[model samples]
Target: MIPRFNDHAANERTYLAWVRTAIAVMAFGFLVERFDLFITYASQNASRAAHKLHMHLRLTEWVGLLLIVFGALIILLASARFLRNRRDIAHERMEDYAGPVGEKLLAAILVLLGLFLVVYVGQELAALSSQPDM
Candidate 1:
């Protein structure tokens, strides 16, 4: 078998980097959602404008939550794969690698994620268009 060349340190570093990115995304999402909640509260205290403001705030919260969950899951799965690859490399069992199955699955997941983003954007745009002028 070919000698293992996978650097555990480098792989670990990459995994940590991804984790940090995931944390950042989650934090940002939480902040955005919280901001929306604050807006909702403020609108409730306000006059007639509260209804529209609440709608906008709800949309923001939903979008933010979706993005945060998606990002976190992606990072988690990527990190898991990276660690698995590193382990396989260390064992010098490169031949037993996910040769085709893993690749196909990864591709499918990426495509699904792309489609989801496209649909989400389209829906957001549609909602915006349907709303009255602010």
Candidate 2:
């Protein structure tokens, strides 16, 4: 009757951490999307070129959407992993830890998202610098 409380507790803690991270990512994504919408609405009275520029700054919207979706996927992954870990610990088969394919995929996606954001910010700065002083 060996107690596996420590193993189960650690697994629960990891699962909770993952959920918290997912929530933060989703909230940030929503904020980004909402901020873009606010900008678009607020610039409706601006000149034609300004409106065009705002319209062209559409990448944030897409990035926000991708982040929200990715957060959801992370939640699902975390849930599945948690259940699998619990089962393995109960059965004393800890040797069969889940594979790293999903984690690798997540890391790759995160890298791509970060790169996209960097490029997007650079473009925005360039465009802003080109504009005449108000």
lDDT of 2: 0.76
Number of the top-ranking candidate, with lDDT as the measure:
2
- Residue pair clashes in candidate 1: none
* Cand. 1 Cα-lDDT: 0.65
- For residues 40-89, write the lDDT of model 2, one tens digit per residue: 65445433376565665575777788799889989998999999888889
Q: All candidates' lDDT scores?
A: 0.65, 0.76
Q: Which stretches of candidate 2 lie over 4 Å from their true place?
A: 37-58
Please give the range of 10 consecutive residues that has the lowest summed lDDT in model 1.
39-48
- Every model: Cα RMSD to truth: 6.1, 3.0
- The TM-scores, one per candidate, come to 0.57, 0.80
